[model samples]
Target: MCYSSNGQFLTQIPTWLIVVAGWFVVHHLSQKRDQRKEARERVDQLVTAILSIEERAVRFHQSDSYQGDVARSLLFDIQRIIAKLKRHPFGSFVISPTLLKELRRAVTLKNFDASKFTRQEANSAILSNIADAVDDIEDQLEQEYERIYLSTEWFVVPSQQKNCR
Candidate 1:
């Protein structure tokens, strides 16, 4: 009954079907790409913030003020980065022992110099080395990001939970 002049059933094959299918495919692909990009940006920001914190930590030790001012600043940033890590849950990067040792030393130094311990030339070089370790971590993280993107599907990780464990 819906046949055309040439006996073709035009009503059975609606033209809009093809258009809708194409639209769905494009929309899905765009969303995937956008999500990947956003995830990458978040990772980059976390790395940069951590690196900056390490620099501040070095400067704090190097500064004349022996109070808790510098350590407080560095702690604030470390907390911020920790929060971000909780959200993304990418545990690929490991904290270097040297960096961890430096952080611990900074705490000890603060306690020891609570009243009167002047910054000496010998210790300044050690602080610089700690800052350099932080820089190395950042560079390693950037490379890891590139590898993750190339190897796996971006933000749509198969596991619903992105636990570091």
Candidate 2:
């Protein structure tokens, strides 16, 4: 009777342990998946903002009125991005110091040499720097996306599947 009771207790312990462990694993996986989804959505929005900033910078560079409403609009976009980052919990998808500095310099150059730079030179210099900053940020975001989504993939077919199909 004692041996039987001990065996029953051992079985119950494994059953309870399995239930708890399974719950923990599922909860952890769910949290990770949710975090990835949030990050992906945030990055997508950030990419759109970066593209808009690049477009606005190009237009500002080409236009005669860098101090006018158009320039203000471009500056507003940058400020908007900064504001968004302030409230974000997981941090920015990607915003490098170099990119930030280049963006600031481009804006400053546009303001200082607005009347000096020909449209073409402004396009080549200020607009090009804006585009480069956008590209760098996007590259960083892409790396993050790949790290999260592409870390694992099947290397070979299973034996049964290989045999059958």
Candidate 3:
């Protein structure tokens, strides 16, 4: 214990203890901020991937001629999304395991034939699945904005939101 000139009693806490505690707090906050930044970046990557897949899917589905190239690219984007979902911070809010499985199966089965769908039904089904996945991700991110803790953060996504409907 120590007494100040004003006759006030000083705490026995050590200077090193205060410094260590401050360092811990700063380190913890810095880590948290870095995590949030990473999560935001992952979301951006996911949206880019989803839009790329949608574009390729639409192009192939609309094309009447063989589109092996487009099909391959689309499959690649789907696989990218599948991988992205594994690290996407919003996984807790979105049910992605089933989506991932279905996307993988779709890629496996159609990687060779997606560009030239023989049946209109197949195109519709594939398109529906892709659209649903997009919508679900968008919804989850939108909901993320409403989170009490994340309110102070910000992000930017492609302008696809206006055209999704």
> lDDT score, residue 111, model 1?
31
In the range 101-159, model 1's lDDT, one tens digit per residue, is 45445434443355764553535655656566566656655655555444454444424
TM-score of each: 0.61, 0.70, 0.58
Candidates sorted by lDDT, best first:
2, 3, 1
lDDT of 3 by residue, 1-165 (tens): 446554342343466688999899798677767866777776777777776666666566656665777767766777666665655465443444665666555434553464445533444766676567666666666565335125433332212222222
Tell me, by TM-score, which candidate is best: 2
- So what's the TM-score on candidate 1? 0.61
CA RMSD of each candidate after superposition = 5.2, 9.2, 8.9
The positional error of residue 145 in candidate 2, measured at the CA in angstroms, is 5.0
Question: Which ten contiguous residues of candidate 3 have the minimum total lDDT?
Answer: 156-165
Give the poorly placed runs of model 3, Cα more than 4 Å off: 1-16, 87-95, 102-128, 140-165
Over 27-136, each residue of candidate 2 has an lDDT whose tens digit, in order, gives 86677567667767887888898788877777667765445666667767777776675555325234466666676566655544555645545537666777777787
- Residue 99 miss distance in model 2 (angstroms): 1.5
